[model samples]
Structure formats: structure tokens, C-alpha cells
Target chain A: MLKESLSSFLRGCRTWRLWTLLGWLDIQQRYARSSLGPFWITLSMGVMVGAMGLVYGTLFGQDMKSYLPLIGSGFVLWALISGILNESCFAFINNANFIRQSDVSLWVYIFQVLWRQMIILAHNVVVIVVLRIVFNVKGYDHLLLFIPGLLVLLLNLTWMSYMAAIWSARYRDVPQLIASCLQILFYITPLMWWPHMLKKHQWIITINPFSSLVDLVRAPVLGAYRSQLAGVLPLFLL
Target chain B: MAEAGDGAIQVQCLKDINLSLDKGDRLGLVGENGAGKSTLLRVMAGIYRPQEGCVKREGKTVPLLDISLCLDDNATGRQNIRLRGLFLGLSSEQISAHEQEIISFSELGDHIDMPVRTYSTGMRMRLAFSISMAVEAEILLLDEVLAVGDSAFQAKATARLREISDRAGIVVMALHSSPAIMKFCNKVAWLQDGAVRMLGECHEVIRAYDQFMHSKEKTDA
Candidate 1:
């Protein structure tokens, strides 16, 4: 079973042309008639970060200068991680027709989901740039770490999405269950709020896998690595 | 075979089926509705894995089970050609080389530039058929795709199919029409209740199946 899964994944990866085009076509079809096209991904993400940064920064008695960049980078990273998890549930089910008709490896569908989410994440990078400029955040030294961090995160998501695609294909309700679980995880993870808020209960963030994965990407840009980098190293090793 | 929703009962769709084909072999499968003809074809195409036995195949296999399977309705005919070609495992360079050939064969003219959603049923089928035929397959698994497009284009499509199948090393087709079977296949397998009821020369097996159908019809009347 392991050999079969591994071979199927390798075969699907080798067919990068197919999935890349399929992913691009998905983005095109989504914004076909609209003028803003995929810029809507940036526009919506920017609006959410702006609105939430103001309200949450004030709510938690934090300065906007430090808090805005945190929310901006954190939200963008969270969207990518959550989007892959949520959409992977439908990876096999959405391509049911092609699955039934063609002998393409099942991983092709998984890669398609990941690729489109990555494109959305790329668009959201514009929001990150705007946040950095507006807030005058400086962390260019740590930016190089983003490469290895993203590689680990994507490798973890690939296997996860593959399993989710297979499991959700069999059980119809898995997607809904996953969506609800992610909704709860969203509030608990340190996206809008600082992890230091739970001083005595730092274990909450430590135990949550989502925290480290988000921190891997968000910490580099916002230059806040001291608290979470120690926790993240062991997770990446695993 | 497949399981029920409750997972308590296992429904076997095919069993005790030992079949093989080599280069230059053309096999036709004929059976009543629900006799597992399509299921067997799917098994050969590697879409459904058998619980008991294994299917061993060599060479590239292309199953034209549903020619219109992934043709995006919002995309233009030109883009759909590239999309389908990619799914068929052709590189971008290969698809571009054959792009003009497919468009000309499809006879879409200026309509090829329009979105497929704006096409007539026949026009849509023409585009799909043209794109599917563009692949050069060593093993071709076709399920009732021969009768596409209007009558005028039907003749062109039949000739195209014949040329492609003639070039293919192995061809397995599930068809209901006896004439089509005689035209394409050298051997025939008549399936009954998930088992091969008869397997022999095409003419001999078709004769027996036709007699059985005639008697059953008279008895029903």
C-alpha cells in the first residue's frame, strides 16, 4: 500500500503541466467576468486584515504599529494553511467524473487543490507587502528562513491533503466535519490575538499544531520568532 | 465489486473473468443491461480495481469512456483542446503541434473561438470527438463513443475511428450494435450475471446471442 501510494504521488508530481494548467484555469474560470480578476483575493484579504487589526488591536490594548503587521502576515499564512485543509476534502469528489473516466493518479486532484490555494496565497502576498510598507516593519534578515519553513509546511500539507481526499471521498460528511473543526481551531490559534495573552496557558499554543505551522511563515515577515521558533523546530523535525 | 452504504453486503459486479489481449487483437463485449459490460471495461481501463484478481497491462492505455468528461463549458474550444490534451498525458509542445489539426478536423470554423456553453449539442460533441481522437494510443478502450456528431460528420467520425483503431495495438470496445462489432472486433465475449457466458469468434458468439434474444422476445410476447 505504501509503495502504491508513493508511486502514485511521484507519477502525479511528474505530470506538473496538467495540474498547473488545471489550477490556472480554475482561477481564470472563477473570475472570468469580473474586472478585478484574481485581485479580488487580495482585496478581500486586505479588507479583513484592516478591519480586524483595528478592532482587535484596540480590544487587546495593543499598539497598532506592532499589531497590524502581526495580523496581516498571520492572516495570509492562516488562509493558505486552512484553505488547503478545507478544499482537500473535495479533491477527489470534485473530480469524480475524471476519476471515473481517466486513469490519472489520485494525487493529481490533491495537487490541483494545493496549487490553486498557493495561487490565492501568492495574491494575498500583495496585502503583506502593503502592511510592511505602511507599518515600516523590518525583517529582511529573516526572510531567507521563509524558504525552508514553507518547504516543511507544504510537504506536511501534501500528505495530509492526500489522506483527507481519500477519506472524504468515502464518507460524505467528512468535509462538513472538517470545516467546523477548522472554524474552532481558527479562534484558538494566534492569528488576530497574541500568544502571550495566555501567559500561564502557553501550553494551549504549544499543543496546537496549527500554531507552529502558521508561525513558520508568519514569524519571518513580522520578525517575531523568539517565542515560537523553539516550539516549531521539533515539529519540523517530526 | 462494490459494497453497500451500510458495508454489510458486498455486491460483486464481475467474477471468474479470465481474459487477455495482445498486439493486433480487437475484442468486443456484448451483454444485456446490468450485465457488467461497462464494469468490465472500467476494470480493464484501471479505473476500478478488482478485489480478487489483477489486471496486467503493458503500453499506454487511453480510455475514451466519456469523450465529454472534462470539457469545460465556460472555456473556448481552443482552450478545451489544450485542457483535454493535457489530461491525455500530452506535453504542451505536443498539443500545440496538433492544435490546428484538431480544430480543422472538428470543423468548428469561427465557432471554435466561442465558449463551449454557446455550442449546439452536435457542435459540442464534434469538438470533444476531435480532441479525443487526437491521442495516439497503443491500447484504446472505447465505450459507445463511435456514434457522435450529426449524420454528415458521423461518416467522418467513423472513418477517423477506424483509422485510429487500426493504428492501435490493442482495442477493447463495449458496443450494442452487431454491425459495429463485426466491423471492429475479431473476438467476442458475451457476459451474463458477471460471468463470461460465451467467448469465441465474433461471428459464432453473435449468432448464439442473437438466437437467445429472439427466443426470449417470443416468450415474452
Candidate 2:
């Protein structure tokens, strides 16, 4: 069974063309009737970040320049992390017909979910770019670190998605259970609020794996390094 | 075998089924509803793993079970061709090469660029049949896909199926129609209650199954 699973994953990776086109078709079908197309998602994300930045920046007593970049990049990363987790629940259920009819690797559907979220993340990156330009965020020195960080983050997400897909395929309520858990996770993760806001309760951020995963990608883009969180990431990988 | 809640009961879909075929073999499966014909086909297609046995297969297997199930209604007929082709393991270049042939065979004309949701049932079947027949298969597994489209297109589809089956190294089809089975297969397996009740020449098995059905009907009457 382990050998079969490994070969399935390798076959899925080799068939990148299928998943890439499937992902693009998913986005196209979603916005088929809309005027602005998929940009509507980016536009809404930008509006949310902008509005939250203004309100929370004041509420937290942080300046706009630094706060906007922090929330902007962090929110984009969070969207990707949460999107993968949520959609992984349906990765097999959504393609149940194909699963029953074809002999293709089950990993194909999991990769489709990840690829679709990546496309959405690509669109949401526009908001971060606009924020960077407007706020003159100078974080080029550590930007290259984002590559390895993002790879490690995606590696963790891939396994999580695979497990969720398997479990959700068997149990009908797994998707609903995951959705509710993610709702709580969203509030606890350091997206709109900074980790330092926890003050003496630093263990909350340290214990939450999502915080470390998001920080892996977000901290690099913000030109900050969390060596402590980086130490925790290899543990999650195991 | 599949287990229900808490593994209290197991529903065995197939059991003790030992059948083999070689190159150029065309085998047909016939059984009553819920008699494990589809399950056996799925097992051969590698969709379901048997709990107590194994299915040893060689060559590439392409299943044409429920051809319309993979079509995206929101995408255009042209795009769905590419999509279905990709799902069937055809590379983009291969799909592009066969794109025109599929469109022409489906007879969609200008409507090929329109969403499949706008198609009539017959049109949808035609598109599905065209795309499915375009696949090159070494071991072709089919499930009741013969009766598709209108009568005219049904004749065309039959001819296409014949051509593809002839080219395939092995063909296994599950069908209720005796005529379809006779037309495509030289060997037959009659499944009853999750086991092979009869396996022999197509004519011999069908003849026995027909007599058994008639006797059961008379007993009920």
C-alpha cells in the first residue's frame, strides 16, 4: 500500500500538464458569468485588507506604513494556507465520478486542489504588490528566503491535503468538521494581529503550527526572520 | 468487500472470480442488476481493490464507463474535449491532434464552441462518444456505453467501437443487451450473486442464461 501511494504521488507530479490545465479550467468555470472575472476575488481581498489595515492599524496603535505590509502579506499567505486545508476535504469527493471511472492516481485530484489555490494566491499577490508600492516597503534583502520557506510550507500542506482527502472520502461529515476547525484556527492564527500581541501568552503562538507555517512564508516577505518558529517547522514536517 | 458502520457487516461485491484473457480477446459480462457485473468491471479497471483476491493486469487500461460523467457542463464542447482527453491520460499535443476529428465526428459544428449545458441529450451523447472513442487503449474496459445517441449516431458509434476494440489488445465489456455482447465479444462470463456462474463461448453462456431467466419468469408467473 505504501509503495502504491508513493508511485501514485510520483505519477501525479509527472502529470503536471493535466493538473495545471484542470486548475486553470476551475478558475475559468468559476467566473464564467462574471464581468470582472477572477479579478473580483483579488479586488475583494484587497478591499478587505485595506479596510482591516485602517481599522486594526489604529486599534493596535501601529503606523500604516509597517502595519499595511504586515497584514497584507500575512493575509495573502493565510488565504493560501486556509484555502488548501478547506478545499482538501473535497479533493476526492468532488471528483468521485472520475475516481470511480478512471485508473488515474488519486493524487491527481489532490494536486488539482493545490494548483487551484496557487492560482488564486497568484491573483491575491497583486494586493501585496500594490501595498508594497504604496507603502515603499524595502524588504528585498531577505526576499530570496521566501523561496525555500514557501517550498517547505507547501510540502507540509501537501501531506495534510492528502490525509484530509482520504479521510473525507470515507466520511461525509469530515468536510464539515474541518470547516468548523478552520474557522477557529483562523481566529487564533496571527494574521491581522501580530504575534507579539499575545504578550506573556507566547505559548499560544508557539504551539499553533499554523502560525509557524504562515510565519515561514510571511516573515521572509516582510524582511524579518523568526528563527524560533523556523526551529519548530522541521518538527511539523516529521 | 465493503464494510458498513463500525465494520459490523461486510457486503461482498465480488468473490472467487478467476477469469483470464489474452491479447485480441474480447470478453463480455452479463448479469442482472446488482449482480456484481459493474463491480467486477471496476475491479478490472483498478478502481476497487478486492479484499480477499487480486486482479493481475497488463497494458494500459482505459475505462469508458459513464462517458458523460467527466464532461464539464460549463465548458464549451471544444474545451471539454481537451479536458476529457487530459483526464483519459492523453497529452495536450495528442488531444490537439485529435481535436478536429472529435469535433467533426460529434457533428457539433459551430455549437462546439458553446457550453455543453446548452446541448440536447443526443448532442451530449454524441460528443461523449466521440471523445471516448478517440482514446487508444491496450486493455479497453467498457460498461454499457453502446446504447448512446440517436439511432443514426448509434450506428456510427457501434462502428467506432468496433474499430477501437479491434485495435485494442484486450476488450472487456459489461452489457445487458445480448446483441451488443454477441457483436463485440467471443467469450462471455455470466455473473450471479458476486460469483461467476458460467464462463464459456459467448453463444453458450447467453443461451444458458436466457433459459434460466425464462424458467425463473415462468415460476414467478
Candidate 3:
């Protein structure tokens, strides 16, 4: 079973054209007949971060200057992570027709799901850029680091999607359970709240791998890294 | 019986099956409902993994279990032709070369430019059959999907199948009608309860199956 899964993964990677076309089709099919099409994601992200930046800034008693960029980038990266996780659960199930009919490697569907989510993330990145300019966050020196960080995050998501899609296909309820778990993990993670909010109990967030993952992407983009080594070391090991 | 995830005893859909086909072979599969005819074809097609035993194929294989497989309903019929052909292991160049032929063969004309969902069921079937038949393969597997179209279209589909069979090295088809089997296959495998009950010349095996069914029917009466 391990050998088959590994081979499927390699074949899936090799068949980039197939997955790319399917992923592009997925976006087109989704926003079909809409004016803005997939840009609707971009629009919603812009409004969400703009509104949340103000409300959460007041609620947390932080200056909008720093908090807006922090929350904005944080939410965008979180969406990429959680979106991959959530969508992977249905990857195989959704492609049941292809699976039963075609002999393409099963990993193709997993990659297709991840690729489609990445396309949506690309749209949401527009919001991230706007926030960065508005907040004037700086750290151009660390900007190149974001590329490697994103690559590592994508690698992790590939394996996670592979396992999740298979397990969820068999269990059927795993997607729902994962949905609820993500709902709670969202509050626990430092997406909206600052890490300093935990104070001495910061170990709580440090121990949670999700925080490190977010910081991996969010910190570099914001030109800051609160424990750069700490945030990225575990992911390297993963 | 296999143990399902919830601890329920689930009957194995296929078991204790062993058969082989070689180059220049055409085999017809005939069986009652739930007799594992489709399951065996799926296993050969590499869609379903068998719990026991193994299936090995030498060259490229295409399964026509469902004509609409890999077709995007929202995409134009022409696009679906390319997409379905790709899934069947045809390169873009090959599909493009056959594009015009497939369109004319399906007789879709202007409708080929329209989304597949906008076409009727018969039109979709024609599109699927045309594209699938266009892919040259070492092995071809078919289910009941060929039972398509009116008499005129069936005649065309039959000719298409004959052309494909002449080119393909191996053909394994699961079909219901003895006449269809007699028309295409040179060998036959009769499956009963997931096991092969008879395997021999097409007429011999199918005649045995016919005898068994007729005697059983008389007993019931």
C-alpha cells in the first residue's frame, strides 16, 4: 500500500499538465456565469480584512498601523492552510467519476484539489498586497525567505491531503469532524490575536504547530519573524 | 466476507477469480446481476483493486465502462472530446488529429461547439463513443455502454467496435446479449457468484450458460 501510494504521488507530480488543466477547469466551473468569476474571492477577502481589521483592532485595543497588516496576512495564510486541509477531505470523493472510469493515478485528484485551492489563494493575495501597502510593513530583506516558506508549506499540504483524502474516503465523517476541529483551532491559533496575548503562557501557542506554520508565511511577508528558527524548524523536520 | 470499517460483515463483491487473455484475444463476459461481471472488468481496467489475486496487463488499456467518463458537462462537446481522449491516454496532437473525424462521426455538427450538458443523452453517448473509439490502444475494455443509439446508430457503433477490435490486441467486453457476444468475441468467460463457471470458445461457453438458464427456468415453472 505504501509503495502504491508513493508511486501514485510521483506519477501525479509528473502529470502536471493534467492537474493544471483540471484545476483551471475547476475554477471556471465554480464561477461560471458570474461577472467577476473567481475574483469574487478577492473581493470578499478585501472586504473581510478591511472590516475585521477595524473591528478586531478596537476589540483587541491595538494600533491599526501594525494590527491591520498582521491580521490581514495572517488570515490569508490561514485560509490557504485550512482550505487545503478542508478540501482534501473531499478530493477523492468529488472525483469519483474519474476514479471509477479512468486509470489515472489517484494522487492526481489530490493534487488537483490542492492546485485549485492555491489558485484561490492567488486571488486572495491581492488583499495581502493592498494591506501591506496601506500598513507600510517593512522587511524586504526577509522577503525572499517567503518563497522557501511557501514551498515547505505546500510540501506539507501535499502529504496531508494525500492521507486525509484516503482516510476521509473510507470514514465518510472525517470531513465534518475536521471542519469542527478547524473551527476550534482557529480561535486557539494566533491569526486574529497577537502572540503576546499569551504572555508567559506563550508556550501554548509555541507548542501548537499551526501557529508556527502561520508565522512561517505571515512573518516573512510582514518583514518580521518572531522566532524565525522556532517557527520553521519543526516544519523542516515534518 | 470482508470486515467493513463499522465492524459489519460485508460480503466481498468479487472473490477467487482467475482468468487471462493474450494478444489477438477477444473475450466476452456474461453473468447474472451481482455475479461480478462488472467487477472483474473493472479489475482488469485497473479501476478496482482485487482483495485477493492480482491482475497484470502488458500495454496501454482503455476502459469504456461509462461513455461520459472524464467529460466536463459545462465544457463544449469539442473540449470534452479532447478531455476524454486525454484520459484514455491520447496525446493532444493525436486528439487534434482525430478531432474532425470524431465530430463528423458523432454527427454533432454545430452542437460540438456547445456545452455537452446542452446535448441530449444520445448525443452525449455519440460524443463519448466517438472520442473513446478514436484512442488506439493495446487493450480495450467495454461494459454495457455500447448498447447505445437507435438501430442506425447501433449499426455505426458496431462498425466502430469492429474497427477498434481489428486494431486492438486484446478486447474484454462484459455484455448481456448473446447475439452481441457472438458478433464480437471469439472467447467467452461465464461468471457465477464471482467465480468463473465456464471458460472456453464463445459458442461453447455461452451455449452452456443458455442451457443452465433454460433448465433453471423450467425448474422454477
The candidate maximizing DockQ is 1
- TM-score (C-alpha, index-matched) for candidate 1: 0.94
CA displacement after TM-score superposition, residue B167 of candidate 2 (Å): 3.8
Output the worst ten-in-a-row residue range by lDDT, candidate 2 chain B: B159-168
Could you give candidate 3's per-residue lDDT for residues A129-210 as a string of tens digits?
8878877877788777887778877887787788889999989889999889888888889999888887778777967877
- TM-score of each predicted structure versus truth: 0.94, 0.94, 0.94
User: What is the alpha-carbon lDDT for the whole of candidate 2?
Assistant: 0.85
Q: What lDDT is reached at residue A125 by model 3? A: 92
lDDT of 1 by residue, B26-141 (tens): 88999888898888989998999999989999987878776555677888899989988888888899999999999999899999899988998678778877777778877878
Q: Model 3: per-residue lDDT, tens digit, B1-221?
A: 77988796877777677777877788999988888888888899988877777899998888878656567888889878877876776777898899999999989999998988888877888888788777777788888777766678878987766666676478888888999899888999999998888999999999999898889899999
Candidate 3 has a DockQ of 0.67
Q: What is the lDDT of residue A229 in candidate 1?
A: 55
Better of 1 and 3 by DockQ: 1
- Note the B-chain TM-score for every model: 0.88, 0.89, 0.89
Write down the lDDT that model 3 would get.
Answer: 0.83
Each candidate's DockQ: 0.73, 0.72, 0.67
